[model samples]
Target chain A: MNKMTRQFEGYSFIGLWIIGFMAFSLGPLLFSLIISFFKWSLLDKPVFIGLKNYIDMFKLDPLFWKSLKVTFTYAVVSVPLGLIVSLLLAILLNLKLKGMGIFRTLFYLPSVITGVAAAVLWMWVLQPDFGILNYFLSFLGIQGPDWLGDPNWALTSLIMMSVWGSGGGIVIFLAGLQNIPQLLYDVSSIDGATKFRQFRAITIPMITPSIFFNLIMGVIGAFRTFTQGYVMTNGGPLNSTYFYALYIYNKAFQDLQMGYAAALSWILFIIIAVLTLLVFKTSSSWVYYETERKG
Target chain B: MNIFGKSVTYAFLIISSFVFIIPFIWMVSTSLKEPGAIFAFPPQWIPDPFLFQNYKSAWTIAPFQQFLENTVTIVVLTTIGTVISSSIVAFGFARLVFRGRNVWFAILLASMMIPYEVTIIPLYVEFKLLGWIDTLRCLIVPSFFGAAFNIFLLRQYFLTIPYDLDEAAIIDGCSTFQVYWRIMLPIVAPALVTVAIFQVMNAWTDFMGPLIFLNDQRNYTLTLGLNLFRNSYLTEWNNLMAIASLVTVVPLIIFFIGQKYLIGGIAASGIKG
Candidate 1:
């Protein structure tokens, strides 16, 4: 009887959490999937319309394609650029230097200011007129294009801001870099490997796991880019920054097209799911696991 | 390393640090400058008059005190709820040998990847049905259920504690709850603190949740208030900067003080994956 009571008590500890998961996470997910097949306008009764939302998203909606293009462009461009820049920063910081901790802290500072403040700060930084970026451009005897204001440059400006916050990636890469054994480098140097050769041969292969992790995360994160577009441009200057999440937000809240918005979000979920699966499928080709080899 | 290589590395680090640090310095400078001096060519690094009243003006322009109070209430409640609920669920997952535990744990891990956008529509409708719209409950209640990431983090920490300790406690007449509360909780206090910090930062800086769920100005969190303030006071650059700077102070202080745990948490999640 005591054992039975203890067992029941142990299981009951997870009861509230299970209830929450069902109501908030899983229930909502399944409900969204169902509502995507219906016309749910928040007031009117939801009418069943099977696969019409998906068909419209694929065949009829221009903004769907536009937003997808914007999201993909941002993701494809920013992820690689962010990866290289952060890895470079990590490599630089990995150099044995006094006060490297201070530099690391400074680099990591911007990522901590993530929401509206970061968005507002970036708006001023990338302001076309009387902005510091343009002010600095004048010294080069060149005219700076309107960054967030220009149709052609708006998305690019947001990508630049995204790169600025890759400081978190730097911290992650720094941790990965430190995990690499120093003996490997010493052996490479003894074998007359140049510094560049050592990096290409040693650093790149060893840190590929971190790279893979960051790549997957960056793609998911970039696809859902919202706050910056919502704040800085509002998908403006010809919808140049009409990202997928912004579109979903507008459709659901601003336009009251909750059913269609639900459909769009499900499509995004599938896209990320497929992309992540593809990365995992291909990870075996490039991502080196030290344990796999040793074991 | 060679002397030439070392100098090049130092030079790169110093220049990059300046690049990273300049925007913040500029923010503080702009917050203290008069409106007329803000757009001055070859911008003044320092305000001539140092108008500190911009913060006061910024405060009065918005119901910032109310926003702060709302944010504090939300952060404190969410943090406590997250810590308590996540620790409980994590203990069950880590210590108990229940049927279908692995399947449930896997489902929990998979839920982390489902974007908030996928669930926002129904979640909004659900909250509306519950009459939680425009209230703090929409934000705080969901947090009490335990986040997947925090649960996962704490579970990993809990798994490191020896099962022998639980057996010993059981032999000493402690119930399962006692083993969890009196024994495991104190042992995993560091992990609990880590979860609390992450939850506080998350609740404090959360923008999308408040934007979606909140309708009334009185119910706005600091992030929403700052965004609304920016929209209404587009030309008031000094005041905008002042408010933005003010909104950043809590996260900045937390980041500075608990950077080790913060970075360690990230590394743990990233590398273990």
Candidate 2:
């Protein structure tokens, strides 16, 4: 009787959490999925319009395709660039040196100053006439483009800011680098392996898991790039920075096309799911796990 | 490494640090400059005659004090609620052998992938039905339920605590709730602090939540307040930068104070993932 009572007590503790999950998360998720099939606005009753929202998003919407392209381009360009830059920085920081922690913290600062503050700060930083970026460009004898204002450079400018803020990835990669056994590097050195050779052979393989993790996360994060667009550009300079999330936000809230926005979000969900699944499917070939190694 | 290699690394680190820190330095510089000096040719790194009044002007231009008060209330409530709820829920997952625990845990993990955009619409409708649309409750109450990432993070930390501690507590006639509160919670204080810091940062920097839900300027968090301030004062770059710098200082201070815990928490999540 005592054991049974304890079990019930334990179950009830988690039961509270389950109730919350259903009410806030799971229930809302199902509601959105259902509403994606209807024509609902806040002021009107939700009219059943099965599959039409999806159909319109695919067939009728040009901005949908444009936003999709913009988001994908961002993920593709930013993720790889962020990965390579962060990995290089991590490798540099991984060296046994005094005062590396200070540098690490400085590099990681940008990631912490997120949202509207960072966006506003960047607007000034990328200001064409009096901005620091153009000031530097002039010194190099190269004319700088109007960054956030020019349609040609708005998205590129966002990507630049993102790469600068890839400091979090560097920290993560540094942790992964620290986990790589020093013994392996020592053995490689003893066998006359050059730094580059050892890096290619051992370090790359060892840190593939971290790379993979950062890649997936980078993809997810990049696709949801909203604040910069919302705050800095408002998805403008001719909608060049109109990210999918920004588009969805405008659709649902501004235009009051909640059901259409729900459909767009579902499409985004599917794209992310497919992309993530593809990465996982391909990960087996490259991701090296020490515990999985067999003689 | 040799002297040449060391110099190369040092040079690279210095340049990279400059790139990372320049915006902040420039922001502070611009904030202190008079409007005439702000757009000066060959941009001023330092203001000749510091307009220290920019900070004062920035504060008065908008209801920033009220915004800060609003943000602090939300952050404090959410952080405390998240730490408590997530830790307790994580304890159940890490210690208890409840039925369907694995399935539920898997569901928790999977829910992390569902983007906020996917849920925001219905969540808005739900909050509207509850008449929570223009209130701080829309922001604070959902966090009390426990976030999936925080729960997962705490559960990972909880698993590291030896089961013998729980067994010892149970042997002493402690109920599971008592074990969680007395034995487990104290032991996992570091992880709890980490969760608190992350929650505080999230609640502090949250833009979309306030943007969507809070309709009144009086209830606006600092982020929404600052964004609206910028929209209204498009040409007042000096004041905007001043207020932006002021708003950003809180998170910077938090990062500096909890530097070790924040990095360790992030590293823990990354390595485990």
Candidate 3:
């Protein structure tokens, strides 16, 4: 047999065995779609409402809009800033300087920490009264805001808490940096390309794929962010930090609106799908393809 | 290289390092502090008198013994489930030729795009109907099936494994499953460790899953229990810091020690974002 046919023959078992995985992974997801279409109350039989849940959320619900606004604001402000920050750190970290490994590990340490720990720790730091943050500020003769308790600062505080342990992005960026061949740097240097130019031309283009990956994943990940919001703020300070996921969580578990929650899930699904498509659409301009496209 | 560039790198590195280390250093320091100085600033780097009593305080506040037990048990189960199921499914996707393979694989790939949070509501209702709330089953069941990400990882790694290895195993009269157990699994040790560590770390630090499913309090995992201690009050700073420190630091210490393994495994696995 030819290489293609042999490879095909080799992969033939996946056809049969994937059934078990498909059943479990896809079963609940399919069930979710059915639940999304109905007014499922668990206690009673679900009533089919078609797309009423979507309609209600778009035109009727008050909290949904607020949650959407808060979540979108977070995604926009944080993603690009985080990308730039982490990429800069990745470049510095990629340096051949001594003790850089220690620095790398120290930076990466934050990501391994549970979100709960960081959230709790920040609650103390952001505390306006008797907090170490405020105490330090008093030395400078300035007062600190009640970060978690203030409506305006609440979401921003949550964002700060989110970025506190953002080392995973750095790890990916570092790995991407490693993939850029040394020759690129060598040739650019021979041409007397300045350090800034080398970085702009060499570092940026080569890491475009990872940057695209991180951006898409970052947005998707941001939308699903719940731990800090659930732990630190509990969607409080007049619901300024009330994220979409948190709102869905409250609707399902707290208020027993399973149908509404499922509906919310589908809504989130649509949003993410559209967003993913948008990223891919825009990626043609920025994302570097390594291989020639058959098309 | 410009002197300015070098100094700027150092400047950024130093300040960023401080930002990273403060919470960790404070966590350890406060754990060793007396109750009176828990929040005192310049946040006394050295507690006036080192207290071993904080450990005792942290232990007594919750059924942490049960929390530890539950956390360990669930993590072990999930790790085993993820390893076995993911590898099995990955092999099928990786090695076998089956009908509608592209369609099924595409379905699995599509599942990766749908965020895990999207399924929580249906899962909750499904589990509630099955009366699995507060049970460890709720925690492990979802992961027991091959996750799309893991399956994708294993498939990618398996693709890299030479076809010659499987052919040689088959020539020795090995069944497909035996070839998998004897040849495939062994060769994929690095990938397995990578996945195992990922599972362990995720299970160790996961607060949201246990917080939602585990309602009995006795069934609380380390992360949830630590959250409870911290969230209890503004004044219970000593107990809060001590307990939170204990739980958060445990897995981190383990990861720190195995940092080489984690860094190596992550690089080797080449996991998709």
Candidate 4:
């Protein structure tokens, strides 16, 4: 410990920051918890209702199951597909060649686009009649499905959009690719390993850590998806794309069932948390942590 | 490494790149299209008689300028609050030897698990009580407290800065505040930038916050504006797309203009936990 010649005793920066943080966050955080217990809409004062709202959501919310189904369905389908595409894109962009920076920039550009904009752009493209998709389909004498307008295809349409704006994951994949030892690749080349074989042997094993990272993050992100549903379809032609977050949102905010929404939110959080823990537990078998060997 | 494999790689990259770029390219082209040709049976890559009136009309239908102002006001305040709040909190967790520091930090980490859904009910009621609903305060205030994720993310960077800086400053009769403000802050500038960029983008593009909190039409953000377009003009293809294009993509395009800074920011944040 050192003696201070003149301690600045007048102001407390830490206190100011805490005061600021709590001033803004505490009300919302605490208020939300308080409201989760009572049943109230914006019109009337919230009345104490105990666990009735919670019970009702779990037992009776019709759209609850449907929303869960749609969300998990999208998550299950999109996560692996996105992971592979990002990895493949990262591998290509990491090549020893000229103008790769341009390619990298191009691939990452779509991700930064707001989800609303992407939805709007794709809405035009995916419009069944008079849209570009059908026009292309007509050229091949194949008709395109009604994307958002069709109940059956709306969720899938959103899934396709999720895969498109995957620049964030692609960046992480590129970082993982860069961390690979060049000596391993060079040695494999000397052994006359085919590109596919080398990728299987060296690249895949080496990038397991990144794979685990993306897998966990992808699951969490997928579970929390509400933007596309809000933007593109409003959960759809017939609630086809209504995800868990959107469902809780509609129940609490739109429909004004506060307690029920809290219950729903808790359920979704638990499901996601469990899914994350599962991934973490499973990773021990496949994941290659860099420091584990030394320990 | 083989020549044939290299060609295959190039082909995959070129084709996939085209697929990814198509919607963005088409969005720009369609925004400029005349009313008659917005969704012409055959998709037109080039708009004939490129009408820029859609932009003007779109602006009128939805107050793009007003929405821009509202969004900017909210985003700027939130980012400033976030930078001021999160970095200091991160500093406390990174350097302080206070009782319950570990416990409080753990609580912060745990809060990250509690999604927006869990907190929406009480917040809505509280906002109503505080007279915050339909105001920019509702949008900006919740974020000022420093998100758990941001605190954790920045704390990771803060921990990696050499403690020698703090020790030397202490020897020079510097207080903890002086050590934080003068000695340690400069080294973590990139992480601060990263935090700033993330908060800016999140606040700027945020839909749910504005959607729930803002009831007044004038306060709607770009996200809420886009949703309004879908609801109101369900059929007016060209104008809506034009407005959506500018509102949604423009901020990101502008944000990334200094692209190297963002990359450097991420790398700086990457060195720690």
State in Å the error of residue A44, model 1: 1.6
Clashing pairs in 1: none
What TM-score number comes out for model 2? 0.97
Instruction: Report how far residue B133 has shifted in candidate 4, in Å.
Output: 0.7
Q: lDDT tens string, model 2, A1-295? A: 3667757866676666787788888888889889999998878998999999999888999999989888889889998999998899889888998889889988888888899999999999999999999999999998999999999999999999999889889877887888888999899899999999999999998989889889989999998889999999988898899999999999999999999988888888887778888888998898887778845
Chain A TM-score across all models, in listed order: 0.95, 0.96, 0.89, 0.87
Candidate 3 chain B lDDT trough over 10 residues, lowest sum: B264-273
List where candidate 4 sits over 4 angstroms from the true fold. A1-37, A45-49, A190-194, B264-273
Worst 10 residues of 4 chain A by lDDT: A2-11
Off by over 4 Å in 1: A1-7, B233-235, B270-273
Write candidate 4's Cα lDDT for A22-83 as tens digits.
Answer: 55455455565556678877687879987777777668777888898899899999999999
Q: Roughly what TM-score does model 3 have, to 2 decimal places?
A: 0.92
Residue lDDT tens for model 2, B3-120: 9999999999999899889998999999999989999998999898999999998898889999999999999999988898888888888888856789989988888888888888
DockQ in order? 0.68, 0.68, 0.49, 0.46
Query: After TM-score superposition, what is the CA distance of residue B233 in candidate 1 from its true location, in Å?
Result: 4.6
> Per-residue alpha-carbon lDDT of model 4 for B45-107, expressed as tens digits?
889988888888888876768888998898889888888778877888887665556766776
Candidate No. with top DockQ: 2
Number of backbone collisions per candidate: 0, 0, 10, 3
**Residue B122 local lDDT, model 2:** 90
Q: Is the docking of candidate 1 incorrect, acceptable, medium or high quality?
A: medium
Output the better candidate (1/4) by lDDT: 1
